[model samples]
Target chain A: MIKRTISSIALALGLAVATIPALASEGEGLAPAGTNIRDQASLQRGAKLFFNYCVGCHSLKYVRYSRLASDLGLSEEEVMTNLNFTGAKFGEPVISHMPADDAKTWFGKDPPDLSLEARAKGVDFIFNYLNSFYLDPTRPVGWNNTVFPNASMPNPLWELQGLQTAVHGEAAPGQEAVVEKLQISTPGRMSPEEFRGATRDLTAFLEYAAEPAALERQSIGVWVILFLAGLTFLLYLLKHEYWKDVHESH
Target chain B: MANVFSRIGDWVNERAPNLAPTYRKHMTEYFAPKNFNLWYYFGSLALLVLVNQIVTGIFLTMNYKTSALEAFNSVEYIMRDVEWGWLIRYMHSTGASLFFVVVFLHMFRGIMYGSFKRPRELVWILGMLIFLVLMAEAFMGYVLPWGNMSFWGAKVIISLFGTIPYIGGSLVEWIMGDFLPADATLNRFFALHVIALPLVLLLLVVLHLAALHEVGSNNPDGVDVKHGPKGNKWNPEKPIDAIPFHPYYTVKDLVGVGFFLTIAAFIIFFAPTFGGWFLEHDNFTPANNLVTPSHIKPSWYFTPFYAILRMIPSFFGTAIWGVIGMFGAILLLALLPWIDKGEVRSVRYRGLGFRIALGVLVFSFLALGLVGAGVTAEVIPEWFPGADVTTWENAFGRLMVLGYFGFFVFVWVYTRFGFEKTKPVPERVTMHD
Candidate 1:
């Protein structure tokens, strides 16, 4: 009967483990994100870049500027001097002064707030999107993306990445030219490898923005498991003393 | 100090003579059959899990936000800012999953030994009521996170009420307290999850134990140790086959609890989400009313019935029948005490037909659950994975759902003809070896 119960427990545990199944990735053109959320230095650099460029248009409504000090390991004074652009208070949400209605009319739509964007679109999607922009003659901004077709926003990092041109394949009959590949027509100050690293940093920062506790959770988890192990050993000895009769009789 | 404690004890004893007697009756003197098996461990463990949930749940409410707008961020806040909040949240979430696992095994024990058989019918009924309340409690609690899955899972379930022809739309509106599931829905669910269902659940659990104590425990042998002719058969004052639950079973139960906690710690600390089984990845994203996820699955515990709900073709015109089918799967368990016509109690005494049916039922139920978790989730889910069995999955799902119902029918058939076969019931308790 103990064997039956043991086997049953094993079977249930097996089934419980089976429950998650493997996850299938969603979304297209999502190049694998090569960023680690644990990379604090990269995240700090990403915050600097975000303050310089993305904050002028896109706002991170959910993040607090104050949180960056503790999370990204920046000093409050450093954050104020380096990253604070709108002269806001330390505890304020990362909001931009650009009015939504005016920006919407100017750009065909207001630049969406990016508080939950990293989570909404995965890290891979954001990473690839940063690298996918290219020049298109017919578009309003003279820019387009293979990742996101006819994107209204011009290349936000075009200067750092330089201008990219889509090399097209021969058209089939009346069809439009298929962009077979991308080429950097004009090189920016940063090399392709450097730009990739920069984008990786940005992706890491966004990933942390999505779940700031990701790094600490697993580390703290080790101690929690250890504590439970100690408790189990204490309980087991007490239980052993009580079960002396049952084992002897059986 | 001893004299003072004795005076207080005397004062309590004078006020209530039944206190010590009741304690002795239920705890010290309760005569459980000595040959009880490892399957008996879960009943107390279930109680332990229940206590863990209630305690952790109370702490969670201190920090949790009940509004849909703030709920998602608030969970993250708890996970991040609150002291040891992640640990508490994990314990609660993991406790919910463990609660079902513990209860299911306890239920299986009852089935194996026919604990639901004669003289203990009320205990079974009360237990069944507790199970129903637990489902409701879990359902309400699942929505409190207010993530994409929580919002949409609640939406899909509440929309089931809207399937009721004329009053359906109004019923759903009234339940939601708005046009759709939003702040009002989250708030109401919060109240019910924390207060109403738990209140009823505690009461039912109490009743379940009280009723169980009145009849004493059924053992693996399914023999009544309480009654028999003294000296000639078995003692009436104290059955020779029975042992006191306190020193014997209490210690045994503690060991079970230790094992349970070890497994629970493994889940809570290491895999809090249980790899998307306990917590879905979609739930990490905040709820969006405008966009629907391509695939929506219920929490792992509820998936078996959800699969049944989806498997039924809605050719009967309205979806009301499918809704009925989903609920009927659970409601059928309440009838188990009366459904089986078998004279014998233990599965050991039952013929092969009954065992075969029991085996199939377990298989079908598990198959349905595995399928519902998203077909063959055990395998890696790549789009072009070679094991893709999209069509086969649908067919397999349909068959398993049918087999779930067929098991009960098979029970009705086997009980009619099958006669008991077992080694003679010993007058004194005997070990299997």
Candidate 2:
């Protein structure tokens, strides 16, 4: 009886383990479908959004002002005068305006660096999340997110994008449903389409900021692969020529 | 004119086959039975987890400062200031634990199926190397936040290497490149943990998979397939044996990858730092060498070994023994094929001795792990009269340590003399038809 119990338990455990791989294959979230985010113009707009909105709270500490200026085709003087804070030089990093302790105390969370934000949370997630914010007065920030719940940070771009609320209602029997459509309660500077475009640019900029080398690396990779392929072809031809004489002689 | 056009078409077809073989040929060529079911997925999952770690880690490193003063603050900066920085940090931190879980499963699979057997020795050895490198990576990564546990945990683990006879002190110094696990050690380890070791791991993983594909896979049955279908009772049809790697394995892997990500995401977004084991409260405190943390422990993965190490009495020699036992556990696995001499590969046909030995081995490990976590009972008080330790507790601890070592010896003996010789093979076979 003990042996049978043990065998049964083992079999059950084995079946569970076997099912893991099958169950694992579902719902890849928020990575854009079939889109390569390599357009230079898109990256440029993304940089502009990052500087205007994101730099106030989040710092790209690893990225120097000079590097950003050169990469994004901005003048060092423009970067220093417009974007630079914390009395940092042109070669210095984009440090946050808020002190760590104070930020933590005020927001109940410290603001993180934006440098690698894009690489960490893919561009689509950022894009969708920025647009997903809806009003919730109960939360610490007076704002809630569909993508991220109970977010401590308020919608910083609310002035430009305007206040939008989600309408909640019940679904039919045996269904789980909560539908949300943005209804502007208060108007801001930009229209909805324009606001979305701005957010897209911001997300793109953050993505570029996260891995500034990605664009260069990808382009370089293409050339390198091409060169290697050509070399392989040459080697193959050489092998054929060399082997032909041996086969004929034999 | 029609014949010339047809000839041209035929020429294109002949060359096209070379460029891209028919689905059937391609399937036969590459999709040949990995025969690998559960165990095979973990390595690939480990790779996916590694990539996740790297991506998340790079972002965290961007904002993270290694300086003693700013290290803790910078990490906080990432959580708050950077847009979605919190998400990235959680993903990377959670990924470190997940990496170990997958690798452990992968290594255990290697053991259970005798994937480490003879010709595939290099695969197992490389895996051990990867495991060691992973440990180092996790250790270095823990120290990056410069939290309370990070500082003291490094101190304790580093202190372990200081147990050798004459050159012990020097060896520790050499390993750290300093007197202690200080700023220089953190910096170099950060470099190694992020860049150097990952590259090596990637290369080793590729080699590990290549070796696996070459040998096909050892199933739970463990039958050698070289002797044709007559020797083995089960035979997978040629078409089933040959599935295209691109669509079939790729889709399968993607599904597995998706599921792994979902679990990881749920943990990262929902419940990062599930209390004591995942994220210790003390780790939130900044690193302070002046003040030693109370009851410093390594991450959950290392707890079992750490528990074993602490069970030893001497503060000095105990550390050395811990290191030996940890490495010995892995090194012993490399020699398992030679150690177990049963002619039949499957555990199904194995004798009572093997089963009992396996059970005991598992139990001993679990007991050692429990003791390592410092779960001691106060049953008897006479073991150390002067000291604050109880007799039963002390004896239990010592017994578990012995049991841990005894498992290897038990398996070695059982495989040598306890098993019977195989009987003659059955000739007749019945098919489903």
Residue A172 lDDT in model 1?
A: 94
* Regions more than 4 Å wrong, model 1: A19-21, A24-35, A106-155, A162-193, B35-38, B227-236, B376-391, B419-433
Candidate 2 per-residue C-alpha lDDT over B187-232 given as tens digits, one digit per residue, 9 for 90 to 100: 8877888789888878887777777666655544455543333211
> CA lDDT of B92 in candidate 2?
86
Tens-place lDDT digits, model 1, residues B211-300: 988888888878777774332122247776676788677877877787788778778766776756777767877788986866788888
Question: What residue pairs clash in candidate 1, if any at all?
Answer: A21-B377
C-alpha local distance difference test of each model: 0.81, 0.66
lDDT of 2 at A199: 82
Cα lDDT for residue B410, candidate 1: 74
lDDT, residue B430, candidate 1: 49
Residue A122 displacement (Å), model 1: 4.7
**In terms of TM-score, how similar is model 1 to the real structure?**
0.87
Note the clash tally of each candidate: 1, 14
